[model samples]
Target: MPRIRSSPNSSLPNPNAPPITTTTISTTTIHTNTTVDPAAAAVAGFFNNLLNKIPLPRWAIYTIFACGALLILLICLCICKKCCCKGKKKKRQKKTDEKINLNGVNGKTTTALVQPDVTDVDYGATKEKQRGKFLYSLEYKAAQSELIVGIKQANSLKAMDLGGTSDPYVKVYILPDKSRTCETKVFRNTLNPVFNEQFTFQISKSSLLNSTAVMQVFDFNRFSKHNIIGELRLQLCDVDWNHVIEEWQDLAGPAKFEEENLGEICFSLRYVPTAGKLTVVILEAKNMKSMDIGGSSDPYVKVQLALDKRKWKKRKTSIKKKTLNPYYNESFTFDVSFEQIQRVNLVISVWDHDAMTRNDAMGKIFLGCDASGNQLRHWADMLSNPRRPVAQWHNLLSAEQVNSTLTLKKKIPLASKLPF
Candidate 1:
């Protein structure tokens, strides 16, 4: 029999030698044998050889392997935890970025129509904030630097100044340029003043969205300062500039809008350049001053056009009775050449018609550059560019003489100081 010895698989490898395998066998003719998986056996053998080479005891070596496995597990857990935290941080950063995009200080823009046109209010589309009728039209001419506004008229209004009458006039301007655009003529003691007047503004279309139309109504006063009865402010952006929109609007007043507006007016104008004629249509006046002892006074529009220096041609609308605001729809024409258009002056005076006494001058206005700066501008625009109709509301002069009163008022007080 050949002498045989088995070496353990736990022994370290020799240089330039093949792999080792070990087994225990009992030769009793009833042999017992066992085999392990190649891959599993190789892994176990590698650990076993590594442990056998260590100088530590078997128990100590086993302890070191167990601790090393535990340490590896702890490191994996730490790395996984760090990865999870990093993922959450990334999610938080994404959310923060979205929040900044949705809301910012410089991101807000005005979209709602601030104050809209007031017309025959439907009462259906109205909110609690919608008080009056809103009706107006705006045309934006970007190249011309102009804004054209057409205001027809207002219906029912509250009387503020007098017992049952208000000398209502409309003054409009684009805010941030509060120099004052133009004002409608006062209807006299009547609540309603017909101003079928068209107004124009020299404004760039680009600035309209940021600009607003500020309108205020005032009662005309010859002796006292005009009192602000109410106001109507409108935003340009809200208007549908494409189509002409008309609706009834309630006029809002400054804090103390005590009562209803007095009334409104209607008037139109035409300029025939070739014919050398300037025609003014005095539609109507309502709620006028009562020159009578008890009842409402007869009211009419006294129309005058300055033909030459120290000469003013006069025309009159039919007298209306009882009611404060009278309607005349009467058209008056004056001889005006293209050259004379600038030189001639149009003066409109509202008078109280009295059967017994002389007609009392209620209110008069010089419609031109000399008085209403816009009048001359309007005249120039019409003559230079004729044929097209141009209309606007002109504020009536508080003084009977629109041209002279301003300088006279200034000089009347200064006379005492002028070398006395």
Candidate 2:
């Protein structure tokens, strides 16, 4: 249905009237709100400046800084750990010392070789600084050859225990003749112990001029070696013997050693197979080396027995002061099996004591199944007579020579042919 009609609305004749075109104007404004931190900016700027100045890559520089920081942290940790460990050790040591002190105060005995908390320098200084005094009275009766001694008390004695006190006892003896020795009862936990004790010694009037009275203060230890606090020595010749003389004497250290001559020793030996007991008695020593400036010596005996020549057991005798020919009738016993007796060596030695220095060895002697001459004879005698003590005198050899000879190994004899 198409009818051809002229449509005036479709005409394009409005071109001049106002080709009033369409004008579209779009206005848009964007606002940005952001803030920057000054510290972060400064840090970033510093890092950027550093990175720019260095020739290395950023990753390499950052790795180096990280490693340096880690190392610093590790070092700080180690220092802190060491400081903590040191603090702990100090605390533990203090606690142990306090415990020992408490035990000593409670009359309980603690066995130790030495004080673990004290150094040698500090111990020496303490020992030298504090040496106390003792009171004593002496009387000599010329008619009865009796010398009476009284140990009244001690004051301001050195503190030798952890409790800052001492369990003290007194030892009184006559020098040059130590056959008679006396000791007082132990007083516990005290720096001032009063021991009102008396003792008597038998000596002729003629022997007084050559004898000296020696008194020693010692700290008692039940399970270990005792410690000597101090000592006092008085020449009997200087004392007036007619009346009882009482005085307080200041304690002193032992005298230093001087050179003298070599010595000789005599001893006895006995063995019993039934009871496994072997006895050795140290008899006497002669011509001992003088250790003091006053031309006298303080000598002690040490007897040692070697099983298989390597495992050795030893015993010691008391010291005899101011004598060249000293007598020590001390005895020692050992448990030796029947099989072990044949492979044994007995060594007897003499030593000079020095309080300020190491003890000096004067001489020594050894006897065994491998020995010769007098030593062999003595061994044979001891083995031939079981349970009967046989004694003899032997010349002491020099330390160097004896040490060389003792290192020699000899075949152990059979039990059947072991001089028995």
Candidate 3:
């Protein structure tokens, strides 16, 4: 039994065990008419050759390709998201701006330099809105009790000069007390002027309701009086003090700007304390009212010294006939002691000389220690610099306006009031 042992690798059948019956298992593979793409095959072959050339394992190659494909897909998605967000943000901002311009917070359209919708413009309103618009800012500071005003710029102003442009400036006044005033520098030959100027008004919270701000745009003239282009009056009671108020407002026609055109005069003053002498040189006068027919005047200046609100001494300059702007360049001296200078007031009255009738008072101005505004300042300047001449330009006022401002002792007789 040990002599004949069958090996596992032997091809002959082993007879040691009982007779074995083998059963055959059959399998069927169905053949369909599916077509193979040559392009796909070439691509697959190219990738296969590329992957085979790499030293890494097959698993690492497959992981790298999968990671690369996922990274590219994520980048594309991020770009698309950013573009969509930017477009949406722009549209939203545009819509918000339009809404603000159309319907402002306080029911008034606070349209700035941006034009409002055509439907929002009221056709029944005055046509002065088409004249121009100005930009400004107002801020109320509660801590300091101040109203800070900023005059930014103006656009499309009317031209008053012969040229097709305008020399413009801005005047800011706090009314009904117009003592507080600020003026901007004149910009020459421009329809649109930028006045980056600021002014401060000392206003308490209690007075805010009663306060009003007047901003006047004026056309500057070298030879004639300045003409008011337009104006904007804003009442402080209508403002919201929670934040700054900044807007572009349409300019309206000035109602009472004619009073501002009373005209201006330029003169120099010199006071010598040791000599007790005060000299006044009438340099020039411009924009005087035309008192005579044919729109001209025979103008002359009457300078008088007033002590205790009564006329003490007076002098006159030769009349410049038929001239609105007269150049006098004449100097007059007065015996004014240092003690008397404090109470003395210099009265300048411009008169139109007439042969047939009484002289007409064109305008008048007074300068003294008790004078208000520019008059007081000018008098102080002359006193501060003794013996040195100080020159200034003063705005003239009507006779009634002058009388209302001065604290006069009594009315002068008509004989002494003559300009001859």
lDDT of each candidate versus the true structure: 0.63, 0.79, 0.83
> Which run of 10 residues does model 1 get worst, by summed lDDT?
405-414
Tens digit of lDDT per residue, candidate 2, span 1-420?
A: 333444345456665574434445556678999999999999999989978999998899889999999999999999999999999999999999999788667432443344443566678756655788889999998888999889999999999999899998887777775555556777879999999888788889889889988888888764334678988888999998767999987787654531224766778899998998999999887877777889987889888887666535789999887788999898999988787788888888888887798998888777878554356667878989999998877666666545655663445455585543
RMSD (Cα, Å) of model 1: 26.4
Candidate scoring better on lDDT of 1 and 3: 3
Ranking by lDDT: 3, 2, 1
Which tens-of-lDDT digit does each residue in 1-420 have in candidate 1?
Answer: 343678755677676677666555555446678887999999999998988888999998779889999999999999999999999999999999889666533434342234332532544344322323334566777779878876656544555564777666666767665433566655656644556777787777778877887766666553334566656777888887676655556667554523223233445557787898788888765545456777676677878766333344678888787667676778787877777676666667787777777877665566554544345545555556566655554444333235443232221223454322
Runs in model 2 with CA error above 4 Å?
Answer: 1-129, 256-420
Clashes of each: 55, 1, 0
What tens digits encode model 3's per-residue C-alpha lDDT throughout 177-218? 554555676788998998888888778898888988999898
Q: Name every residue pair that clashes in candidate 2.
A: 258-291
Taking all chains together, each candidate's TM-score versus the true structure is 0.36, 0.37, 0.45
Ranking by TM-score: 3, 2, 1
Residue 375 of model 2 has an lDDT of 62
